[model samples]
Target chain A: MLDMPFIRIIEGLNHTLENVIAPEVESTLAKGQLFAVVEILKQISGRFDHKHELIVEDIQVSQQMLTTLIETFTAAAIDIPDEFQANTETIDATAMSGEQLRQQRDRLEIIVSAALDLLNSHRAEIVDAQKVEHTVFMQLGKNLFRNMLLVSQHRFDKISQLDKED
Target chain B: MALADNSRLASYLAEKLGGSELSISKEWQNTEGWSMETFSLDVEYTKGGNKIEQAIILRRQPVSGLLEPYDVSIEYRILSALQASKVIVPETFWYEADPAVLERPFYVMEKVPGDVHFVTQNSDPDYRLIADDDERASLAEDFIDNLVHIHQSDWKSLGLDFLGDPGPGKNSALQQIDYWSDVIERAGVRAKPLVTLAVNWLRTNAPETDQVRLVHGDYRTGNFIYQHSHITSILDWEMTHLGDPHEDLVYVLGALWRSPAPTDWVCHLLSEEDFLSKYEQRSGISVDRDKLNYFQLLLDLKAVGIMATAANAFAQNKTEDLKPAAFGSILDLAYAALAQHLNERLSSC
Candidate 1:
């Protein structure tokens, strides 16, 4: 699940271009280009969605990390909160839609984050805390590498050009 | 608060400057800035029977942006206080806080003459930011000297105590962590485990600083203006505050502003060794590698906070500008970098 849906992004782009930016265009070529962009976005509005496999991969990694975290806490005699364990157990990604899987991933990541915070607070009590932290970091590293593949290169130069003209 | 047109601005300037036949010759809002709304106004007027022309910069608080709870007055106050210091800054004219004037708090200052250079990953390697080696060296010296002046200036004497000193010891580091943490919470973005892990690591490993000096929070190459190999003005004081000097140093050495590959100069001006040594020698403050490491993580956290805030602004429909939306969309990129760094650092520790 994307934070802002792909449809909403397209709609926003079209709305801003047509209503806000188009009226301000003075050059005919720029105006035509802007309208062409709006038209193209409209055409492809429903043809695509964020990759489902990426969300599934994120969920799997998070689940594995949480499982290891629960085991580490169990071995250390640290009380794992029932809420945390319940969130960990609710990772049912199978047969779920992309949106559902994304929500699951987001929810599980929040729980995992809280669990890490809990671990930090109890670091003095846990045996080999560094080893446990290192384990979580490595798992997070995997997720990060996968997530980065989805990020697009920033077009700051293009943005700067628009700014100069505006 | 909608002072949207040039005519309204011209009228306001006429009233403020006590000039007659005033008109805005040229005016444009600086769309490159993501935080505050910056507008350049070239005005022609008559005062005391003499024709006057001036280029003035007006910075107004934005409705929502990367740094929110917007207040243009703090920047105005900082620039106002720094007028007599050795630091090169634009001349402040007046600050108008009443909403009746511009529909938001705004300030006007002399539009310093220069070009603000931008260095991108795709920029040519040989001529990334400054082409001439001598010009680059000159700019590097001015950059280091200005930073030293900023860190060495007495905040209290300069009446910059309003920025709230983050007192001695580890308070500087801890204060910044808390500050940026609050920004993240306010942005209300989804939790990423990496951010939490890094925050925890930062808190657990925060170093101490006996001296608290003025830190230009966003100091780097792009934030300044250069003319003929000289830095005419150091801009963007919105993030200025009192903190450990190392915070600014770490920020200057961030990878975001460096020249691409073949020449990995810090801020595309000088090497890391040169920056640190010059800063240390000039300010008489010893550079701490451990503190630099800690602040590096903190800097990453700060970037995450800014991006999250930008994303939140767009997500909430606070503004129609798509820049925030684009910035928000790239939050994952920052997370990936932060996660990789944390993995390396935590494993070594």
Candidate 2:
């Protein structure tokens, strides 16, 4: 991962902020913010080594959730689309970049949304459709929370309201 | 600086004001807001053989913004209408639709004197909105009173119907759902299953409006200006439109606007009970808890829409400003809040 060009780009940003941009900014407030940017760049560089591992783990979780959801719907005799069933089969997470893994997750999410919609369309008539829908909704909710936690693992708390010190 | 040429703006304003001479000095530029670039300037001009000076601001729509390819003229008309009403807003002066002047559409208005407090005083030493506890309580009272005034005013009387009335029934909720859904689609971000589910839930549970009033879409803390312990003017009407009043109330009460303290103060000004009771008493409208909760969820979805738009703009390289990109950084927090709200709604279901 160190050989990745993005890491070098992050390094260059850090160098420029520390050496060039921070010095040119006149306001004390602006300079402090510029240095903050430098710090963020350093943080990004620190994550490069484990970036793939994190993305793979997230993709694995998403796939596992979708696979379970499909089996649950099938057991309930709820008809899901053939394409939706096929997409959740597997993904080459190890070979994929973070962006690609995110795309895969998004694809699974869309499938889950379609399945939920299908379950809901007949919720009034189908005897146990409500139960099936609840189960799918709960699983999707947990998946979203876990995925968000992965995405924001390194982000800072939002800065205190404008001009107030943290 | 977003303002390309200082002299061009000066010349344009001089002609507009019918002044013999005019000079514009840049006083300050606010980098906090994402949609509009706020530039404060001291304008000195000679008009009718009298020299006059005043502080004003230029809110210009940048190419890369939270809500882009939008008409600044809509905001101009809303403010113009509200100026005659009870809502405390900046005195709008002019609206420039041509992009040639400042490279984008911009408007000029009087710069009300004040600062915004984002953090609670106890948490942040620099919190300067109000020092005394009494003044703080008064400001909260006035804040609710101002909101009541806004809610009570007749939008039709103010000639703000050009904002397109969403009509009666559940039309208001449906219209907003359609609008923000379009924004999310245009934003073209990765599929957000939670947002999609939330939108579905909102559609399924769309509430009927008792009355349609002018709804300030972004009526939260960090959007208003405070001076001497009183709110001088409510700023950021860019998202203002005709909708259900509950929309505004829900936005004001959202988690994003509150202090981290244990108090249930809305915007760190008034307690929840006090805010609602005062609003009900002053506005003569009963508070609807179910509708408030519904809109709270929708507002969170709207926030996700905003972040998606910002992320889209950042991805498209429309602007290199870090602010829009920074908005994307908070998706996790927004998602967590949405999930909590979703769980609550599911339990009721």
Candidate 3:
């Protein structure tokens, strides 16, 4: 078991761009939009009350952004492993064609974007805390925190090995 | 003082203790490494079965060093002078500049204990969390206030005027920029494009120089030690030199110190604006925003160049710590930031 103390969040925002009625086709261009979204989240909000909200929002939005990014990445015609999916054997035996993969990537991009907007809407209501579902932020922050821990641990392992060897 | 095993230092200290029979106890010191490497030392001397215990630091020069090499006498003299000028510092105990004693110049000073925040872009959860917003703001304000006091300090009669004369050229800021740029160019392989661009921009837009002030070369969050909500000591001063009055300000507001943002004040508890205001009120010298921006960019450049130089040395196997491959990654990450900062500054200019 481990404990890493978190710092105070100074500025937090729920910056969202809604394009549900008008979808973005160029997922490659959408990647740039995701970067802006991350930048906006990087702002540190108040440390005492809304910080937990921001932390949770950061994780959900980050994951949602990554999901969109991966879709666009694959839409640009990337070969991905079936293991990335749940129950890979259960998926259709019909191998996805290049065009089909691109479409899947594009459509999945919309789903991810929706997920991000969902988080944004949840965050938007925070000016008045009574409006937001109490359990929502906690659930999202917890999930995102878990994923971040995994990624950080992976990088740290590589760093330790490199440090020891060099 | 606690000794890192395999250090041939204890016997060396005992043999040099003159006629007094000596017993040594050691403790760890986690601070400055410029003038002298410090370690806590407790010595007991017995003459005719009567013993007296004394506590001090074992200060020695590093054989293969990282920072600029300094003369031992300068530190001894400066601190001795500051003690008289009302600057809080450890009382100097002993100084041995002869290499024959410890194979390097060394000195011992009084040891003070306190909590240190180096701000590694990481958090420490142990201390009571500042559960309130207003308290964090107050802490940030105090930290900046200290810097104001430091800048407002009188070194006129302090005898610290003996350190270094301002280099050639009446404009100290340009002179400093030229000097650091030259150092960067000579210290690396191919010039880093971003740093090179920043250097050129600084040369083009020189800030009007002010009266020379004592610049603590490495004044950042990590340098100060604190205890019970009070700053105990400002640790590193090896890079202390006479130069631009804005040098210290830029360092405090530099990208490294602004790791999280200029807002998340560490060690001290105030926003960047709060700190600057405190400085203005105390020192009566309005901090020029233009010069501050230029110097802030310079600070980012200087930091990257210094880090690059270290990584390069480690890569070439010229340094003791052999982790260049790992440390190089840090330089690479910072390089992007340096590039962005350079572009932003240039475009603004």
- Report backbone clashes per prediction: 1, 1, 20
Please give, for residues B124-144, the per-residue lDDT of candidate 1 as tens digits.
Answer: 666566778999999999999
Q: How does each model score on lDDT?
A: 0.84, 0.72, 0.51
* iRMSD values, candidates in order: 2.2, 5.8, 20.1
User: On a 0 to 100 scale, what is the lDDT of residue A42 in model 3?
Assistant: 52
Off by over 4 Å in 3: A1-166, B1-19, B27-36, B46-52, B69-77, B122-142, B167-170, B258-263, B266-268, B323-329
Comparing 2 and 3 by TM-score, which wins? Answer: 2
Name the TM-score of chain A in model 2: 0.54
Taking the tens digit of each residue's C-alpha lDDT, what string does model 1 give over A18-64? 98799889999999999999999999988767677777777777877
Q: DockQ: which is higher, 2 or 3?
A: 2
List, residue by residue over B1-349, the lDDT tens digit for candidate 3.
2344423555555555542566665466534332246667776666456676667666666533334234666667666666764345567766778786656687777667765553434334333234355655554555565565555556666777786657534466676676676656554522332343455556656766656776667776666666666556665666666766677886776544443443455333445776777778877878888777777777766665565555544444343433332343355444455555555564453
Quick one: best lDDT, which candidate? 1
- Docking quality tier of model 3: incorrect
RMSD of each: 2.4, 4.6, 19.5
Q: Give the alpha carbon lDDT tens digit for every residue of A53-111 in model 3.
A: 33333334433444443344354444433433321112131364333433343343334
Model 2 misplaced stretches (Cα beyond 4 Å) = A1-50, A64-79, A95-100, A128-130, A141-143, A147-166, B120-129
Whole-model alpha-carbon lDDT for candidate 2: 0.72
Chain A vs. true chain A, TM-score per model, equals: 0.82, 0.54, 0.22
Worst 10 residues of 2 chain A by lDDT: A152-161
